[model samples]
Target: MGIWRIGADVLVCSRFTVSPLAQTMAALTALHKGRADPGRQAWLREHLPAYRDRLAGDRVEELLVWAALRPRWLADFMITPPRDDDRTFHDELRRVSETPAEVAAADLATAIGAPLPPELRVPDLPGRAAALLEWIWTHTVLPEWPRLRRVFEADIVSRTGRLSTGGWAAALDGMRPGLRWLGDGRLQINTYDNPPRDIPANARLSFIPVTTAHGWVTWDLPDRYAVIYPCTGLLADAPTSPAPPVAVSALIGPARADILTRLSEPRSTTQLVALTGQSLGSVGGHLKILLAAHLIHRRRSGRSVLYYRSPLGDRLLKPE
Candidate 1:
């Protein structure tokens, strides 16, 4: 049982972020435990074999066993990663390389609660840990990131909507099943194995939604805190490529209908053009009309604008 005390100042200061490195690490943990959402399980069954074939050595697996297998050791090093509009794999690996050595050693010692292993006791342990993360990124996660990111970003958008409409309490309660929102500025989380601890007031809490984490995971660093929770509705249907529905096409025209279907995963205008084989001018025109009708919403990611179907649009597409 962990209770995070939230003062008014902390509540206002806290924000949401998405972390690619966190998701990659969480995915490795899921693979090792063989536990995942049903949809993700099916995805892994199909994709894991190819991912393993691409591994150059057993270094990544060894690191997973040594650092990530248990939650505590990795928690020290996997501090809440800095957020960005277009955070990339290389960018995060660079952050790993920059972790302070003392912090890494202290975290490892505390996590193990015993004498350090011979190999890990070597000088420059931070560099070695960073190297292991880079190896995992290069071999396993980078290839699938494009597909995984869409799920992560979409979850953020949905949660943001909940936060706006019903305030923090409503938003936090919806994140996972067992979370408890005790009124008067406190939130209690049920971490099965972790001992009870109280987070001090005024600490900034970062809530991160991850596609790979099965349940909630937390990181308590100096003045910053983070909770990584599973993304809801991800892989629930595991959409297969399908033709646009005739009824929708007739109602909204073929091009508009095609655009809406492609939004099952968030996509940019250029991506849509490439996928639909439509001219830029034609796609832009359809997008304008769709946006006017509240059938889709757009958000910026780096230089590109991403569009996903709105809740109204989702209802319209449901089969009779």
Candidate 2:
């Protein structure tokens, strides 16, 4: 068990963030491990071949093999990562370029748990690592990011609601199994490397959710400690294409019924418009009715308002 002693300052400064690079790395790790929830595994099996074909001449496959071989070490490079907010791939790649060479080498050494190979110990190691990651991001993750991000953002939305309703303990403990808030400012984490440590009062704590993470991966960075945990209910919540039952479709117009069915996953007005090919105004109108009926709930994510079916909505759609 690992204990993170949270000080008052740390508690106040902590936040929940989504990291694209982190998710990409976690996905790569999952692919490497060949262990994922059935849904994610199925996704990988179907999509990985296309991703590999896109790689063509890139060395991303080799890098994935190297990183997979030393999971702990490769993970350390992402510790105290440069990107913490919703940012672009280019922004994170630039941050990787700025990582000090010595710092990269030391992290690499720790990850390898042995002397670094001469080639990998060079001054430009960080740059090389960055390039490999950049290639991986461009070839494998970027195409699927839009859909994957919705899952991550929705997880954040759900957890933020939990935090508001239940306070810190409930929010933290409920993230995943094997994490406990052991009152008195102590958090117990069940980890393979169970070393107890204290987080500086001034340091920040960030909780990041990723679709690819099977459980949780913790990183002690220079500015804060981060925990990357699996986002729950992603596959189960993904939208399906089966048409609503005839009686239900008759109650609500076919358009509204279709909209409700597609809302199994949270979607923005724009997304709904694109998915259903309905005009923005039409989608908005339907959403308003659904909201009034208490059949769907809307939450604001940045500039976008995302809507999802409420429990009542789910019940109405279910077969009688």
Candidate 3:
């Protein structure tokens, strides 16, 4: 597994940030794969057709996209270390557009682990890469960036709360499939067979949440680093699918019943707030009522208390 030896100083200095560019790049990666996780399937379907249409005859663009996103690798220029002040997408895109042409070629070759394909051996690689990203961002990602930003904010909110209450152990676990906080100072970022790295002592660590199903880590050594992780699209379908029975909704009120419906798996108040987009007070109140009626059970887990649907609650949610 890929382990990072992060110092307590680095941990303390870590912060959460959002990047429209990273989100757009991740969506491009999903498009290259021609698949998406269930949470992002609708987004893929919506944009992929137009994407294919645009790339259909553009040989250089097609090969560049494939090579930049080789499995287990990404061209370094594609992953800029985000800054607190670089607030606009164009601010970050400029980093790609201005990369020295040689550096961009080297990065693509490193990602592909091969000599440049003849088509990719062209001038102004950075400009072309930037242009492709701009097209994807303008056409596909920017339209829904507001919605995407909310998901990023909510994930950050849920995580920072965990960090304060439960420490890094709570915040890092499950951010990605293979990431975990090993005891002491070791943080496993992935399960790849790679050498363990020590983050720069003065580095500002940032965790970036994206809406796409995939993610990666990048850094401009000794200064800025980012861990992009998947925080699925907002849970908009929570109240729609596996709907509460009419009788259940009627008995409990639609809002409370929707909360009950989500509790088949245990979740904490913080988790529910992030997933449901409800205020802490409001979610707590619904939990109180459900507990009073014995429709849910609460269990203490470390620094957090978790809630789950009770047997009676399950019976009520059962399909008619």
Candidate 4:
């Protein structure tokens, strides 16, 4: 596993921050890959065609992004961790644009884990890559920033509240599938077979959340380390919308109806706790009621059991 040996000082100083650049990076990565969560399918359909058109003529830039953003890796040129007080998206992107050509090329090679193509070795790599990122921000991400920010804020608040009630391990675990807190100042960043890394004393650590499922590590080393992770707990688990109709609420009771309504997308109990701000026992009891009534069905997803609305539940919501 990629263990991060965090010092007490660093852990105490660690923060949960929202970054426009990080969020934009996540969105751009999703655009490049043509993916979106079920709720954001509309967003993807709206932007993906334009994104493909933008990349059609720019082979070098297309290759650069494909190489720069690999699983668990992002090129160093774009790895700047946002300061506690970060600037606007354009200001942050300027750093990516201004990276030395040689440095950016080297970073891309490292992320790609191989040598670069001849076309990618030129002086224009940084500018073109940055321009593509800017286009993603302007065309796809910016229009949705206001709504995304609300989700980000809610996740941050939920995280900080967890830190207060349950301490570090509870707050940090399950952020990513393999991430966990091992106690005694050890944090497992991922399940890679890499050797453990000792974080420099007093270094800043940031946990960034975004709407996209794409996650990658970033650092300025000796001072900063960051993990950009998806907001799955809030985004997939406890949706705030999908409020049940008045008739459905009247039939099942508002709380159970709301719970049934959210089951249109599968969710687990832990996620329900995070989303609904309900106690685990309360959520479990609610699930039991739904299950016994045959209003939902269950399936396993990794370590969690996800519940989804059954046909009966669907009919209940849309009675003829």
Per-structure clash totals for the candidates: 0, 1, 0, 0
Candidate 3 residue lDDT tens string, 164-267: 88889888767877888997889888899999998878888889988655578888766788888987334233334477789888988988998898898887
lDDT of each: 0.66, 0.68, 0.82, 0.79
Per-candidate TM-score against the hidden true structure:
0.68, 0.72, 0.79, 0.75
Best by TM-score: 3
Deviating ranges (above 4 Å) for candidate 2: 50-74, 79-86, 213-221, 235-240, 244-256, 259-320
Scanning candidate 4 in windows of ten residues, the lowest lDDT window is: 232-241
Best by lDDT: 3
The CA-based lDDT of model 4 is what? 0.79
Model 4, TM vs. native: 0.75
By lDDT, rank the candidates, best first: 3, 4, 2, 1
Q: After superposition, how far is residue 130 of candidate 1 from its true place, in Å?
A: 1.8
Q: Select the stronger candidate by TM-score from 2 and 4.
A: 4
Clashing pairs in 1: none
Model 1 spans with C-alpha error above 4 angstroms? 46-64, 71-73, 83-87, 191-202, 235-241, 245-320
Which regions of candidate 3 fall more than 4 Å away from where they truly are?
Answer: 232-320
For 25-52, candidate 1 gives per-residue lDDT tens digits of 7766665555567457765675566445
Q: Which ranges of candidate 4 are over 4 A from the true structure?
A: 237-320
User: What is the C-alpha lDDT profile of model 2 across 89-126, one tens digit per residue?
Assistant: 67656666677888776766666676666546567766
Question: Which of candidates 1 and 4 is the stronger one according to TM-score?
Answer: 4
